[model samples]
Target: MALKQSFSQKMEQKLSPQQIQLMKLLQVPTMELDQRIKEELEVNPALEEGKEEEEDEFEQEEYEEEIGEDERDFDIDEYLTDDEPAYKTSVSNKSKDDEEKSMPLSSGKTFQELMLSQLNMQKLTEKEVLIATYLIGSLDDAGYLERDLESIVDDLAFSQNVMTTEDELEGVLHYVQELDPPGVGARDLQECLILQMERRQDGDITRYTALKILEDHFDEFVKKHYKKITAKMEISEEDLKDAVHEIIRLNPKPGGSLKSSSKSLQQVVPDFQIVDEDGKLVLSLNGRNAPELKVSQGYKKMLQNYSEGAKLQKKDKEALTFVKSKLDSAKWFIDAIQQRQNTLFSTMTAIMNYQKDYFLTGDDTELRPMILKDIAEIVDLDISTISRVANSKYVQTQYGTFSLKHFFSESLSTDSGEEVSTREVKQILLEAVEDEHKRKPLTDEKLASLLKEKGYNIARRTVAKYREQLNIPVARLRKEL
Candidate 1:
């Protein structure tokens, strides 16, 4: 009998704690970085926003030399002695500037709050109120109660502890639908439109005709089969157009209007600003992107007191260890922030310079083909790192604010063998479609031909794909009477 032993060798890569922390910090956009910093400041007493004097102190060589010496040969075991009692350190008061941005209290009621208030106005039994409240909660952002009656019946019994039937829920839903938005609790698009139409004047001919079209010919109406609708209904062309227009004017998304009125609109915050100065593209990181940070001076003084002592007391030794640990964490965070700033600037600068012509002229056709790999190689970083920066960050130029990822597109070869950005192809395709005759809209085949004639060697299917990406409908749907 014989036994065998073997050995193998391989290389592996690992990330240190500081490296992992930096990678995570790099992915957060400028808008969220402030909140992330606030969180860190709350948890780490040794980390705080730097004052002007603290910034000046860090710049001095002597302070750095002293800090480096203290950190070089630190020993933790020297502090943990069996004879010594643990020392209690007082928690630092949070700086007022470290407090989170407080959102002002909204005076107006939210959509759901408004619905509940209206429900209160109805003199219903307690059970009816419970069922009605549950129904309102089931509605989606578009104000449609998409849940089936049976599911809602089961939900009421199980979740709300209220025994109810489908008929009772359906009866209560009608009252909820009578809310101010006119179509608040409809189950579908057709039902929503019907509810809104029922709110019009009783004898209005346009409303009557619109209701008839929607009630009986909804499928035909959606497909834009105006010819069939006119012939089937025996209506005049002008009258039919007016009826369809009336239906079009009704809100399909009633809940969306409620949401808009309830919430304030958010403004886009760009992470970088680019300017053209005498034919030179100047890049500046957003002021918020580079926040001032420093390790706590109080913590440093505690360490210095211990270091200067002739005989270290147990309390002093324990305090030194705690302060040193916090100081290390604070130092790591500050360095990571600086690295994040450097990486963001380097990546953005390379992108701006790479797409120089597009930035200079504000012409989308001038954009060159680029990918994460291209910029990753240029900046000497990983593809994932570049992707993180590109996906979450935005830049504002004289043209407009755009996501950093918008500039990176796959390469497409033209008939002349020139490599161009797919973005360029999409822009040209968009222009052709926009200029198309709606009565006889251009099909994907024609669109592809038009692009080829203009030097893009795109196929019909590819044209269809790009069209879909641009959210343009098929030629049949694009057709108008």
Candidate 2:
């Protein structure tokens, strides 16, 4: 046998250059297309924005040139030449790219930054400043520094190469709490409220009332145990009202300021809008972020010039091939954007039409049965594709802004053997909870029985599952002392 090797050769996994380009285009959303185009212009130097008059003239001339061509026998494959220039016309005036642009630099500093800026004004030792920095980092998304001193001490030691103890962190936490936005770094609600209260110069009964709520009657206060609260605090109705107001005024989540630290709030520019125009609903795609992209005009000119002037060298051929591949990719991306826009409209329009009654009245009860498959069949798209579009995408309807995925629900059988959406059952469950007496909130079994009485016929476990989805606590946890 011809030299047979004992060891098997390894196959290298590599993506084709065209495949890489497609992946890049797929990663960019419709909104970021302009930024992507501008970046390409800076790097390639061949692309240029056409003047309005020039674009108009080009369209007229191109139309005239095609007048004699057979209307019924059009061939896109033939027009795409090996050395031809690729051009893309703007389809709409509104580009999605505007939303991705940076906010104006003139915007004022946020509440959290104002607090940190105030920190610089205070006279403090280097160690105190270092500890303060460490403490600020631990605050959660809600702006509360919910973590304990030991965890913070460990973070400082690991991240800053500075040894710290619980005592050092505790002192820093106390000082930071005194900073502007009074309860900035408090470990809990009680501490957050107490810090804000201690700063008040009046020394009113409010502080004492807050102390009672935070220290002793926290359980009673949360459950809205007004009778028990007034009796235990030994206060009159008017005094109890004032104290309850003070407690309510305190920051429940201390670290709410931390949200400003990372970056400014994202302005949610919706990708689609469904609005009520007269009695009929109008659906529109926000193409403001989408840009008109084509092969760089310079790259196209270079390829044409080289191909016409001389026989291509190996290097020149390689470059031309690369440019052609990129041009193909650019065309595919433009097509995909057009396709994505079409699919979005087709899918959402079907949704809007299906739930027209709900949108018109702004009532959840009128929401007709819908699922991914129902939309998929209507739009002629795969269920998974529909799901992907719906998952993160939001639509601004007359009723409100909602995720497209919110409309999808699994089927449930009714008494007459008709399959109803599980969403209808959830709505009924919510109504039951909302109408129930808070003191003796309906238990899972009672909720299940009520759902059955309403002809839902759902199991107790299913009722419990739906209850958890609504974020309502269990009967015991929901109970007041």
Please give the TM-score that candidate 1 achieves against the real structure.
Answer: 0.85
Best by TM-score: 1
For model 2, how does the per-residue alpha-carbon lDDT over 182-253 read when each residue is reduced to its tens digit? 777776766777777667637677667767676788777776777888898788767877776777777665
Best by lDDT: 1
Residue-level lDDT of model 1, residues 294-377, one tens digit each, is 667677656655555555556655676688889789778877877787798899999999999999999999999999999999
Q: What is the lDDT of residue 157 in candidate 2?
A: 84
Per-model TM-score on C-alpha atoms:
0.85, 0.72
- Clash count in backbone of candidate 2: 13
Residue 143, candidate 1: alpha-carbon lDDT: 93
Worst ten in a row by lDDT for model 2? 55-64
